[model samples]
Target: MAGQRRILVIGATGTAGRQVVAQSLKAGAEVRAAARDPGTAGLPDGAEVVRVDLADPDGLRAPLDGVEAVFLLWPFATAEGMPAILDAVAARARRVVYLSSAAVRDHERRIERMIERSGLEWTFLRPHAFAANALRWAGRIRAEAVVREPYGAAAMPPLHERDLAAVAVRALTGDGHDGATYELTGPETLTQAEQATVIGEVIGRPVRWEEISPQAARRRMLDRGWPPEAVDGVLRAQAEMVTEPAAATPTVEEVTGAPARTFRAWVTDHADRFRAP
Candidate 1:
């Protein structure tokens, strides 16, 4: 059982990492939740919480000790100090499950290569747009009841954070997932406008999407602290999606033995976030 293995969960407070921590605990794994601040990590009582900064390769070594498996979450845009970090992980950990972007950005691919050659059993999970990304509209939706953004036609099968974590737990605790790259998606492909409508339905409000210029959207993203390159990459991905629709996959169900949930279900689960308060 996973109870014998000590799993080191990086980014333990983040979207997918939080779920991994909870599920690993449920599966009886000895979880060492690593965060920059242990007190504020807000993990369960059973966990061995520690301070770890991924940006600092020197400080990363201590956490790898006695860790049988690792749930990696790359929080940076570039692979700076990643080699040293991966080398440290390779020296100790038996396996690693990296949470990567479906876009397969340069940095993600770099980490993938390092892990493959690191001699540790590895699994890559590339998830599509996050359903929680809808929170970006929460403020606007609560105020204006409208989502004003560019690429309203962009189609995406937004995956739920919990579903993504379920697969990570399987790969970490169960066997046969090594060297596998899983492309994950939600149950439906909804356009940006359609997603707005779904939110409106679940929140019992009349919300609509208004198309804006890409330039305006870039400004908004920049104002929110997104770098220029990231903003460009995001808009480019959406622009391509406008014509090429995303498709749902059964990977989450197949791996976790549960059907991938629908966008409507996600909205319902997080309805309080969208509720007018």
Candidate 2:
């Protein structure tokens, strides 16, 4: 809240984390962007990039030093080492804003509880599916102009990383956001199939969505080195979304004082990722 408050951003190399680092710098906060490899984190010029492994909380002391606030993104699949990490964080930073998933799984809840008990002010951002997740289809779109996945009819309000980051920066620097859980989403809901079509429209191609069996998807994900439990969890969530479509939320606009960006806007912003090389 004062002149150039020091902000440390965990998971700075990730999709939403990258935006948070950039936006926090734009807000004139002195940002220390922490990642596993600070040398190649590629954060903005104003940030001070540092190496930190969340699994090894001892390395967090340097990054947390003189950091008034933190934007945390839990990169692990489990909450095994979170308590120690929070302990390190609480020793230095007064506030922490965690990027949580909208699904709100048990592991995430456990982490939240740990943050709550750490005696630090905190805000949890529970964003719906990220629009950037569609980048997983980039390879297929570039090669075949097709996205092959199950649950083509599963409608989800994909939240833009920028909007999520904007709300995050506010919580990191502003007041009255402590102990808040913001359910952030984009302006509209689109089925997976429709999202594919929108990408095609943005990039001037006919991108198609080919529905595959969930078993096939599960196999493919596991082969790609995803954890078996995470693969199964993703598949189960998608299957549930088919009948129970996710809707858009107004929290993004409420917090940032601007309408949440649309899925089309997100596609347009990152059109080159889907374009043929």
How many residue pairs clash (N, CA or C atoms closer than 3 angstroms) in each of the candidate models, in the order given? 0, 0
TM-score per model over all chains: 0.96, 0.97
Instruction: Name model 1 segments beyond 4 Å from true.
Output: 2-4
User: Pick by TM-score: which candidate is best?
Assistant: 2
Local distance difference test values of all predictions, in order = 0.90, 0.91
lDDT for position 60 in model 1: 69
Give lDDT tens digits, candidate 1, residues 1-277: 6446789999899988998999889888999999898988889878999999876777867888888899999898887888888888888888999999888899899888888888999999999999998988998999889999999999999898889988999889888999999999998899999999999998999898999999999998899999999999989999999999888888999898999888888889998888788
Total clashing pairs in model 2: 0
Q: Which has the greatest lDDT?
A: 2
Q: For model 2, how does the per-residue alpha-carbon lDDT over 195-264 read when each residue is reduced to its tens digit?
A: 9999999999999999999999999999999989899988888888899998899999999899999999
Q: On a 0 to 100 scale, what is the lDDT of residue 94 in model 1?
A: 88
Tell how far residue 262 is off in model 2, in angstroms.
Answer: 0.6
Candidate 1 positional error at 74, Å? 0.9
